[model samples]
Target: MQFSADTMFPGDLFEAATRFAADTLAAGDRANAWQQAVAMGWPALLVDEARGGAGGTLADLGAVIEGCARHPVGLPLVRRCAQAPALLMAAGSAGADDTLRALCAGQVDLDVVDAPALTVTALADGGVRLDGVLEGVDAALPFTHVLVSAGALLLLVPQDALPAPTARFVGIDGAQIADRVLSGLLLPASAVLQRGEAASSAAAIAQDLAIFATTLDMAATLGATIEQCIAYLSTRVQFGVALATFQVLRHKVVEMYVDYESASVLLARLVADTVVTGRLAARDVALCKLYLNELARRGAEASIQLHGGMGLTAELPAGRLARRLLCAGFAQGDRLTQLARLATEPTAARL
Candidate 1:
């Protein structure tokens, strides 16, 4: 069945989020963003109502994401509202209740493990040892706990158990990122959040949810960028006429808008499928990511090329928007990695 975005997500939530993000999306004001998110009850959108949350649906979450896309904030809203909640629900661990409450209250922030760099060793006494470096992690927020998956086991490691991050700096997208160095960090049996098949399943689903949220956010931001470009072109005069009057420039802006529209349709379908099936198809999610990456690159170039020198400066919103579009690919796996994954999929899935 075809999905209509208007029918799926609530209008009021999107409007409210748009209003909130407009005033608070500026960089270096993470505390204000967090406070506003809490006030809006965004962090609890996915947690069950009984668990002191809003008991909202995925569509509700999408509404807020769409609104925030007007100006993307650097908060961990995707992880907090989508990934962690999915992980906790899939694990069915009562012990996660306090963590959920803390998250709802904005008392703690959580980050996902990068998975590849870390080495995990299981102890006979039900403990685990971790040793390795997590490179270029966006743990700049006061992340109090980390969600980690070691093979078929999932563990929640407290921030105190690991050393402080190094080489910290604000990224182009205004995220405070650093490299986390882990040396023989050990956690007791109680740290295990899930094990066996449950852990593996939980980790996969959580990541899928996160990808869904992220793709929607990126697409919305691209749409906003397209709007900004149109506004600038219509007003900026050149060669005795507006830039929008130039056929070449008008065509480029149209192309960007078309790409943004395509992404919006794909996101709508993905959201509909998830709400109905309660799961995301990995292949579809990867396809969305790859498509958005390509779209972002194209949009970024067209935006910068059209804006000329102004696009190169940080003082303008066009430049900042383009930077974010380009950076989205690097946040998870780059285009090359995603291409390889698709290349390795089964023949039927590929078809």
Candidate 2:
């Protein structure tokens, strides 16, 4: 499963994803494919060797995600593989050990949906409580645990204890969107990842990891969108000529390439910096998430438009690819919110 630097074309990643997708479609086992992927060491690749991971770099993990996106893997690889581990590491908790082990062993399915708090629901000496609902939780369905952040406090709650499931909505990917009522879910002292954070070192790590995960997700979508466009243009014909041969179509395809390349380079640079500095700014991370996610969405939309009717059908892979990209756009944070945060934050210039 190793890729040589020279042989690691985006096409290679696409082919791997396509093969996985074909197998999933043939077996009618989207969940199984995701399980197999996890068991084959996808999660372990994101954790450091000390934390039961394979010690792979962020770029390496991004490549795996890129490959997985080419097919319908049915698992949130970016969040589980990249975000959760980084958050645990930053939180400095042995409590996360069980969760981490389960993740590496493919024994647990975890999903996180965090939002800024609107009101103080509960207050205690050592812990505070949140009562707001987060927008995207469907991909986290059957999630073992849900991670919640309010102010500087981060809480981990068993999914079953959530107040209500009435907040659920349908996501772009057709998964259940998680919108749950917090009400008064009690958070114990042990549940908090960080308390009263003035951007503690551990909290910083978690934030950076979250940002890293979003960037990787963008990379995955970019890879898939590019591949779909290529496939569509190759087989689709127009006016006794290939659609790819038209000057307009050629320009669109090249634009897709440029978008993918720019996102890829940004991801690579972010990964390298994370390894070297072990820290990245929240604003910069938001910018990356904003730009990359938007780029991916645009790329997918362009691919669909170019492919015409077939692009919207379930029988065509481009449809699925587009759905996944759209879903990823709202996974970590909404694009508008991220953009606004980036614009208003003093760190905007620094990033």
Candidate 3:
């Protein structure tokens, strides 16, 4: 079935994403979209075909991520595609396993648990235990088993395995956010996806990619929002003339475009470096993410200002972009955290 939407698409491949996001994703065919995404070879984009994946590359995944961003789809394609395969490879376990096939087949969704507040313990049974709280966890949600992070190790946990959350809050973009106290939860040795150096390595790499993807998607949304803002201003009339005729509004749009392009180039370079070198390129990714996060916030503010009063309401795209701008910056690491991370990286220099 072909997906369709009432909105004007950005054209070419972007139209498919816009239609898919608006009609399939936004309409809440989440499970079906998961299946469709996998069927479309999204989850397999980063995996080797020998391991039941496409063996494409990170650059391919970046393109998919950019498409999703332009339309703001809610699928967990990043976790399924980049993070899972990267972690599996890091953990030394991507050898045509059933898990990998299942992932490629879209039968499962794996999520990384990189919550800020967490603790881990070793179980006497050669297993591991997780304690403390995980805040703002949006995945590993209800009704499905998912792989999660427990300190340096990865664990396959049932959704029903954990107790009820201690607190729940709605994301600014309407995503489900919760703080769960994960005490007394234990997993056997088989549940541990990685340990020691492998675990840390997998986490650093996967987390960096995940953060990169998130920030880039935010940037794409900024692009679409800018387009919408410009479109609105061109037709909107004030004082018996089009708002776009105003020099002040035109300057704001130009500023937003400059910021957007700057972030886009940085993110593209980071993606290319990761793909070509097959390394985290952590410092570069962090810098790009930091810049994009700030850009999203600044661009959203500018778009809202240019769009006038209705910009504050959900009825307008500006409000949604604003919410995404506000949230995505902190969802990954904020600018200060990135700066500190950069400072600690070995041989850090040259901004």
Candidate 4:
């Protein structure tokens, strides 16, 4: 479906998320706020209507994520919204239907493991002998079930079967990270998402989902960084006058703005292309993902430098935001890896 700029703004969704964040911040229930944003409706929005999704386009998902990032919402909206749906689609399973509905209705938490190495991870072993520790399983702690994949096999595993520990580390974005170990976790035959070449399917889905998830992440970082740069230039003073008055600083701000706009445009176009063409627009998607993510990373660094000491402190959100963006930029696949994939793909090279 074609998305007009107006509808794509997702004004209602943005306002709801903003209000939710504000209330959560006031109540000191930040985690709940994040959960509400995801479970209340975002995941279902990305799924196809037949699968109990809201039938929203990728652009719509991007708009929701951008809005959430502008606030303090901590849930991994991009991963849940984009990755989960892509996994369900790739697996050709309606099994996620009830789960998606529950997610939309705020009745359950949804999480997915994109880690290729996780042995008992979702879709690992085609739902057979589960093994492997998955890294970066977003919101895994609260999730009832997780979609795990290794290559092409996708498996949905109940959380109770996995090993859990009580240590918590703060991620780059101030989100809690928990370490998990799975030792010979077994899955029933019914649990496996049966498909051919489980590894290849898992890899392709991971790459596709990474492109979608990381691109939106870049968009969020772009939005947050732009806001920070604008705020910095407007308030900071240098020399005898305001930094805004300096031509060099002004040029730098302009550069950041350009990067932000370019990334935004690229995100919009990538979503549109993905929606229209079901096949992997692997090259174009990679190009957009690499460019925008790297742009956001550089923009964050520039914002930090421009803001001076204040930027580095936890009191100011720029540093934290930058760290989060940087982590996300390198999260799914780093720029070098993405570029390498593109270079090696004969079809990508020709295009």
As for TM-score, the candidate ahead, 2 or 3, is 3
Q: Once superposed on the true structure, which residue ranges of model 1 sit more than 4 Å away at CA? A: 1-10, 26-28, 105-107, 344-351
Q: Candidate 2 clashing pairs? A: 137-178, 138-176, 138-178
- Report how far residue 295 has shifted in candidate 4, in Å: 0.7
Candidate 3 residue runs with Cα over 4 Å from true position = 1-15, 25-32, 94-98, 115-117, 139-143, 347-351
- Candidate 1, residues 1-351, lDDT tens digits: the string is 111123224489988887777777555477767766776788788888888888888888988887876775656677667787777777777656667777777776667664654788889988888888766555556667887766687778887887888667777877776777888888898888778887887776777677768787778778878877887888889888888888999899879888988888878877777678766677777778888889988998899988989987887777888887887766566788668767865433210
The global C-alpha lDDT for each of the candidates, from Candidate 1 onward, is 0.75, 0.65, 0.69, 0.65
Model 3: per-residue lDDT, tens digit, 26-112? 576666776676678776677788877888766676667667765555566556667766666556653315566777666666655
RMSD of each: 4.2, 4.5, 4.7, 4.9
State how far residue 175 of model 3 sits from its true place (Å): 1.5
TM-score of each: 0.89, 0.80, 0.86, 0.84
Please give the lDDT score at residue 283 for candidate 3.
74
In model 2, the Cα lDDT at residue 273 comes to: 78
Query: On a 0 to 1 TM-score scale, where does candidate 4 land against the true structure?
Result: 0.84
Give residue 151's error in model 1 in angstroms.
3.0
- For model 3, where is the 10-residue window of minimal lDDT? 1-10
Off by over 4 Å in 2: 1-22, 97-108, 118-135, 139-141, 198-207, 344-351
Q: Supply the global lDDT for candidate 3.
A: 0.69
Our tally of clashes for model 1 stands at 0
